[model samples]
Target chain A: MILLLACVLWCVAFRCHEWLQSRNRTTFPMPVRAVWLNQGVRALAPCLALALCLMHSPALGVLFWLGLGSVCGVCTSVLMAVLKNKRGRAPAGKPPL
Target chain B: MRDTLRVHMGWLHSWLGFLAGLLLLCIFASGTLAVFDTEITHWMQPEVPLHTRTALTPAALNAAAQAVEASERQGFSTFLSLPSHRDPVLRVLHYDGYEFTGPALSPETGTSFAPRETAGGQFFYNFHFSLRGGDHPGVQLVTFLGLCLLVTLGSGLVIHLKALWPDLVLLRPFGPRPRAWVDAHLIAGVLFLPFILFMAYTGTAIHARVLLPAQSFFSPSPAGPPKKSAPKGRLLQAGPPLPPLAPLITQGRERLHSPDGNLVLFTADDVRIFRSDASGPFLTRDHADFSRKDGHFLRSVTRSSPTVATMQLVRGLHYARYAPLTLRWLYFLSGLAATALAGSGLVVFLMKRRRSSGENAFFRLAEALTLTVITGFPIATLGLFWANRCLPVALTGRIMAEIDLFFTLWTLFAIHALLLCLRRHAAAAWRQHLYCLALAGGMLPLVDLLSGSHPWGDGAMLFVTVDALAFLSGLIALFAAQHLRRPAT
Candidate 1:
């Protein structure tokens, strides 16, 4: 239980730092916001999966957590890619006539 | 100087990676091996016979320790470790007063065993942290290197951010020098940055605990009054000699519940401490439990502990103690990637310099470091393993001597690289360096066999493993060297 809490705390601390750094930047896109939300959910997923495993079976919980973490990594990568591509595709600000 | 988070972090990553890249390479590579330290130890001690017994009883182990203690005056404060079924020897470790620290195993009767110096296991351990030097000298130097790595990793992160999203998933194997370095660094760092960060923080934390204890949040325990470095005169009337260690063996076997636990005896007038552990759910070699230092058969906690469970947990996590096989391998591969990242980062600096400085003094210095560090440390490490296999048992101060051989050869390699780099065909000199590395690595195993060390022996696995690894890594170096042609003037 303590370990789970510790992990949560560590993730929050790291995310908080990132958020603070990004606060003054241009407003984040909707996908980036969704990605951030998913990261928050993902942070607690390990502990939740572990609890579920204890309530159910260890094998199930472990597989679930692994899947969860892998998905989170993949999703974050994808979101970052999409946001970058969207920015690249938008027309540049018009030059003075 | 950009205010953007990505820009700053990218900058931080580059500088940190650049500075600490080489040393971190050694740390991660050597640390990956440290995961198998005990297995390697077993492979190194060919003389110890494997045990047939599946389990050991604590009482029997204590009894054996008692018996051994009755005859020997100095080895009494020993821990009786239950033998693994895979190997048939009972291990007794005496640390209080011995020329060196090691296990004495009873292969036949499971009673008294002789002491011998084993440096191969320790070499890997030290090499991970200190490069075979003592804590103060070696670890301090490495930590300084680690600080540099921290800076490099930070800066590298910043530089990668501009194209990070587009290039993050890219794993281009063939590219120009900078492109390759960037890809290698980004892929490895992004994939394993969490691992590297944790490792760095924990490593620095551990070093701080040892070298800068004043910085520790928890102060040392005040219970056991600090003793003088050298013991003073005779308020210390020694106790009566311990009874035959055979009885303690019986005691340990009963308590430990395994038949394989061997008693290591220490003889003295006083202070007989018997330690043993149980076999059920025995911790794997990678689990870094403090209590396990006494082996599974010994569960008794000491009175004055310095570090807390939280501290231990962080340390264990950093060491990948609880990682399963798949994760362990993943960690190992990530470590190797980090090493390549570091090595390539250093090479990037050199490759960039060749164009800017050409044949000037500035270029020459960069070229020298590239040769010396890029090749020096690995050669020194391989040489140390070779010494462990070939050195005679009777050699005095063998451990220290083995370390000395590592430095001596490393220095020579550095000088050789320096001289070679200055030759007319500097590029060809690299090819030749790779050739020498391959030759030396190839001959190591043959040298071991010639010196009477058998690779297949029960305790001789490290000699073979290290030898094989050297040869394999050398082959990679050979391949890399072939790809390099003279830079277009």
Candidate 2:
């Protein structure tokens, strides 16, 4: 259950990081304060997850955080890509090939 | 200057990644499977009843000790392995060139059962590092490939350094085929960078001695002299009876501060009680040696030196023997991701070159090889399980037969792939192999059910887990095959 929580936190962190990027600003269309908030969450969530994990054992906690972080990152990336595709066609009105 | 550097790095990454990705696929896949080796072995040997919560008896240990002694008297070095949670049957095992093979003894009683000999999961464990080739050449090749993977990863990171962070979560599965492949390669590579780098470095460092013969780094002290071959046509005299192990086990566990002391290695001079690899994060060879004649505790040897501890940590990281179930699953998933990283790189390599060199013979061969590796290995792996079920239980030398079937199936797939490629039907080969893989994986559970060898009682979970994973693999393969039916973008 703690691993699950850590994984979800990692996913949120990755998503926030994705949204805060300058290149994604046009697509995300967030307010400046909201962007700042996302950046804070992106930084704080991972640290919170790491702390939660370290409550277990330092060695295993670190391993779990890294492994879960990578897997959750991939999941978030794939999920975002799917959502982006469903939102519309590619840029310039071109359909996805 | 930066453009030129990127160009050079891109070329190196592409060519080196393609060359090493082929064998690395097999290594990573097999290594992933090896994480569950004991469970897989349990699945393979359904005849051995799972003795969950069964306490280890002195009789069982002595019986296994006797078996080990018998094998040693016959000049084969063997060890007595105590029952553990993952594997509840005490075993007397000897290295049969490829894997440990022996009789399983009841943990409660001293009765021994002859489980049908199959390669079992140890085949994957051995093949992961040794490639089933002996230590020298196989370890050398794998070590070299590990270096290549490191270099390729370095170059790839350099090429993508600019976009690494911003494109961290960029994947477009519905985009152009080439674009999608690129996204997949980059995403998987970047997300799995830590795991891939850790595994490659630790794995290569563990075998660095093979690459550099002059440097001796933390070699463990041998229990005794090197083993001698068994004498032919000679009746060997039995050695002295082993002392009761129950008390010794208690003493050893107390001394080592490890309740998981699960292996008792017998040498001509003494018996060493070794802490289980699952005991902790350190793969320490800390053991208590006892005199063979009297079973009196001689000395406890613990590798506490900084250098030895560091090496053990490296090995433990790579082997993951210390991981719990959840962590083990994480290792397995991360390993699969690494395999996918290599596999996607292979696909991208082929796809990128297909338009320009589709007519070239070398390109065709590369496609055939890639198909053989990516699809062929899973097919053979599933076939091994099939062979375990289909082969007669009473047949002699069935272990060899099972291994033969594994290789034979892979070779035949290679031939099938080559023929398809020669006929300019490389895409068809991919579809066909995926279908075959789907069939092999989808039907594994049914085959296990029908074989009647599976234990549906105490140990059914192991069998169920293997079947479920195989079926899941089949579903993925089936999906891939159906996806391939669409025209190429």
Task: Find the candidate with the highest lDDT and give its number.
Answer: 2
* Residue clash pairs of candidate 2: none
Model 1: per-residue Cα lDDT over B1-489, one tens digit each: 466766566455545654566567677767867766555555456555443453444445455545444424442344444464433556655442212245554644555444335655545666788864556678887777766666666666665657554443443333244655555556566656666766777777667645555655586667877765423111222234344444444444454343443333322322223332222222211111111122223332323233554465456655654454444555665566666667777776666556667678656655666676667776776777677777786678776777789789878877776676665355766676767677667777777677664435444444566667767877877776766654432
Candidate 2: docking tier = acceptable
User: Model 2 segments beyond 4 Å from truth?
Assistant: A89-97, B215-239
Candidate 1: lDDT of B4?
75
Cα shift from native, residue B171, model 2 (Å): 1.0
* Leading candidate by TM-score: 2
Give model 2's TM-score versus the native structure. Answer: 0.94
- By summed lDDT, the worst window of 10 consecutive residues in model 2 chain B runs over B230-239
Q: Tell me the deviation in Å of residue B305 in model 1.
A: 11
Per-residue lDDT of candidate 1, residues A1-97 (tens digit)? 4334433443343333233333213434345675667566545655665565445434334433332333333334334335434655321222111
TM-score of each: 0.66, 0.94
CAPRI rating of model 1: incorrect
